[model samples]
Target: MKMRIVPIGDQATLGDHRHYPGARLLLVCSLCGWDKAYRAERVIDRLRELKSGGHATRLEQVARRVAWNCPGCGRVKWRCHFAWPPGFDDREAKRLANLYRN
Candidate 1:
C-alpha cells in the first residue's frame, strides 16, 4: 500500500475524528491518496455500538472492525493511518488492515 501525504493544516477538516476530548486523528487513504483528520472518539463509539465485535481502543484496531468506505472512491478496501502530529511522515503512518475487504 502507498501512503498519501496529508498536507499541513489540512487535517482540521478531515472529519469528526479526535484522539482525546479535543484532539483529532489524522488519517490517509493509501489506495486513493486521500487524507483527512477524523473524529476518533465519536467514530469509535459508533463503531462499537454498530458492529458485533467487542470494543477496540487503538486506531488500527478500531479501523479493522469499523465499516469505513472511502469518500474519495467509495471503496471498502481502504486503509487508515495515524498521522503522527507535528510532522506528517508517510513512512511512519501505521496501516489499518481491512481483513474483510473482498
Candidate 2:
C-alpha cells in the first residue's frame, strides 16, 4: 500500500491503515518532522509511547487537528498547541488546509 501522508509545513499527519483500513505503507512528506519519513503505524506507536510517558497527545492532533503551532512556547507546554475535536466535520479539515495554503 502506498503511504498516504498529508503534507504540512513541518510534519504530516499519518493515517492508520491497520486501524482505518486501506492505509498506505510509508508516509513520505518532508514536512513530517522527527524523521525524513514515517510509517502510519509507527506514528501511532510513538504517540502511544508518549501517552504511556504521561505526555499524551490528543487523537485529534495525532490525526492532524492543527498545523500551526506556537513553536516558542510549545516545547515547554508539551502538546499544548493541539485542539480538541469539536465534532464530526471532515470539511473542517479541508477548511483548515485551505486556510493554510492561502
Candidate 3:
C-alpha cells in the first residue's frame, strides 16, 4: 500500500480513514511536550455524538471544532498527524482478526 502524507492545510476528511485503515491521529503540544494518540474511529464517533457531523469534516477543520490546547501549558500550539503503529500492517491484522465473522 502506498502511504500518502496529507498536508495540514489540505482538505483530508475524517472519512479518509477508509483509505488508511487502522491509522491514528497523533496530537503533540509544542509548548509542553504533551502527546497522545487517538483512534480515527473514536474521534469520528465522538464528533457525531456532539452533533458536529464529522464524516465530512476536513482534518484541517477539526482544530476549530475540537480543543487543541495543551492541557499542561494551556497553549494552542499543537502538531497533528496521521500515523500507524511501528511494524504494524493494517491489512494483515484485519485478515487475522476475521472482523466479518458472523
- lDDT agreement with native, every candidate: 0.47, 0.35, 0.66
Cα RMSD to the true fold for all candidates: 12.9, 13.8, 4.9
Checking candidate 3 for backbone clashes, the offending pairs are none
Colliding pairs, model 2? 10-31, 11-31
After TM-score superposition, the amount by which residue 38's alpha carbon in candidate 1 deviates from its true location, in angstroms, is 2.1
Provide the global lDDT of candidate 3 against the true structure: 0.66
Off by over 4 Å in 2: 1-16, 19-22, 25-37, 52-60, 63-102
- Candidate 2 has what TM-score? 0.26
Clashes of 1: 8
lDDT tens per residue, model 1, 8-101:
3422322323221223454555567666665565566666686743334445554455457878977655345544455434343332112212
RMSD score of candidate 1 (Å): 12.9
TM-scores for the candidates = 0.41, 0.26, 0.66
Off by over 4 Å in 3: 1-9, 30-33, 89-102
**TM-score: which is higher, 1 or 2?**
1
Candidate 1 Cα misplacement greater than 4 A, ranges:
1-22, 51-56, 66-68, 83-102
